[model samples]
Target: MSLDTSTRGFGWRAVQFLTVLVYVFMFAPILVVIVLSFNASQFGGFPMTGFSLHWYAKLLENESVLRAFQTSLWVAIVTSIVCTALGILAAVALVRYEFPGKEWVNTILIAPALVPETVLGVGLLLLMRFAHQPRTMWLLVLGHIMLALPYVVLVVQARLIGVKRVYEEAAMSLGANRLQTFREITLPLIMPAIVASLLLVFTISFDNVTASMFWRPSGVETMPTEILSMLKISISPEINALGTLMIVVTVGLPLLGGGLARYLARSAR
Candidate 1:
């Protein structure tokens, strides 16, 4: 028994060590970028020349960067809203009802995420061309919605699957209608998942580059694409500053959403 206990402890310790290593591997680059954003030197490297907020200042002063940032923010916000609404409806239909071609509908809805980004981007571009539609922000928004829909659907559907229908039935027995039961019970229960999906879709849309590249209109740019263009010219510390800010916003949002979800879940319980 002592030997078995020792083996299990060792296994746990090993797992903990591996988990730490994985986190370090994932965050090491972000750490480097954050550090370099504060570096006084223009070039990024180890052994910082000094500390300064010059790069961050430059980031604020750069009009193109600001424009791109705004563009990305706008797209992310719209994508999140549209995707969340559609996702909730789709999740409800898929989970609460059975219809003809349900399987095909589910497959088609999620197929965008399964397909390669390059292929999807190319196809979208071709479709737009064939349809004689001019490239526009709406097109980019549509692309992001397509990309993010599957994730939102999956998250909400998973939450719905674990939820008991008895709550709705109980509400109905108390003289509540379908809409009333949903608003008072089902909606509150699913609020956490919806919030989580909104935050997740926002992040995905903001960070997307490959698919956005094809859909971007002339004279328009997203932060990711702007960063790519800047890199082709030269790596600037300002990019690092922008990246650090993005990391903060992206990481902070999901954390905020998680906290909100936890509170809602506890309150619902």
Candidate 2:
């Protein structure tokens, strides 16, 4: 091997090593949580305190966690649906049509994602106070929608931009109405992006804490809020169990959704 070739090979190997190290650093905490979930000890630390499902059982039995989980689930579901619907429409319009101040409109639509979450949360709280609207699940839902909408719009819009107008125009030339063209051609073409947006919005809403912290009313707690309260009180193995379950669901659902999207895309082709 030449000297220059050996140096280049060493540089590439160093890059690969650093990439793996970065991944390990990011995932190590999650791996620890998964491992600690089965720890029999009440505390969440090392030393292999014997494997047991005690915390998982406790997580199941905890009414607070169950209620919080339910709240988070419904909020995420509603936020995803609303964001996806609005996002698709906004994305389609933004990508397909030109209007006066279109750039400004696009910026406005995506501004929330640029703003700090804490700032948004505080601003929402103030708006609620000024309006005399009580903090409630609906309020939280709206806040989450605002937070997730920009991401949904950006994702779906990027996909829409990549799509050719020829497909839609061809459908229209065949005497298909705008609605029919959209329903038959445009929607399917963007299904993967829509699916991705749904998963992203749902995950964001479900795992939200900063906004939920400001907007959650009395007697209402989302899973993230519940976890925060638990931490404030004291750490327990149950928290680890809860974290593990959340990690599984969050990672698993997106994978499933992505696979389904891929299958649908293939079928459409």
Candidate 3:
């Protein structure tokens, strides 16, 4: 090979190495938490601090933690449902229609995803105060829906683009109305993307601390809040245990989901 070509190849290889290094750097903190979760030390740390499941055991009996978990779960669930439904509607309208101020509507729907959580939180808080609304779980759900809507709309829109328009028109020609065609045909075809987007938004809401913090009332707390308070007063080994369990569930379930989806697709074909 020419020297110039060899030099170019070396530069490309270096870029790949740097990209991998960046990924590793980003993941290192999470890896450390997973490692320290198994540590026998009262304080989670490095340097082979032994191994124990005592922290995990404590987590099982922690009522406050369990309550916070339940609250987070419900908030996420409610937010996911509301956001997904609204997002799907908005996306369908945006994709199908060409009307006045259509681009403006699309921009508003998508703007939330790009804004910082803190900015959204503060803005929501101010809006609530101006409208005389309380900082409650319902408000939290509303904010989360707003936050998750953009993601849901974006994902569903992309999936919708892949669907053939003729399928719906065919259904319509066969005496099926718009509602019937959508319920029977369009929804099922884009179901995978909807499900995936819902799960992702649910996870985002459950794991959120910033937005929750801004919107929460004095007496209420979520899992992330509980974790943060625990860390501030005293670093608990139980946090590591919680972190480890989350890692297993979030990381492992997605892997399992992909495999199951593949298996189902194969079976269908």
Best by TM-score: 2
Residue pairs of candidate 1 with colliding backbone atoms:
none
What C-alpha lDDT, on a 0 to 100 scale, does residue 237 get in candidate 3? 77
What are the Cα lDDT values of the candidates? 0.93, 0.92, 0.85
Question: For candidate 1, what is the lDDT?
Answer: 0.93
lDDT, candidate 3, 131-214, per-residue tens: 997787888898888888989999899988988899999999999999999998888877777777778788888888988899
Candidate 3: RMSD over Cα atoms?
A: 2.9
Per-residue lDDT over 125-240 for candidate 2, one digit per residue giving the tens place of the 0 to 100 score: 99988999888888999999999999999999998998899999999999999999999999999999999999999999999998889889987989999999999988888899
Number of colliding residue pairs in model 2: 0
Comparison by lDDT, 1 against 3, better one: 1
User: Which 10-residue window in model 1 sums to the lowest lDDT?
Assistant: 1-10
For candidate 2, the TM-score is: 0.95
Candidate 3 segments whose C-alpha is farther than 4 A from its true place: 1-9, 260-269
Model 1 lDDT tens row, 184-268? 9999999999999999999999999999989999989899999999989887888899899998999998998899999999998
TM-score of each: 0.93, 0.95, 0.90
Clash count per candidate: 0, 0, 0
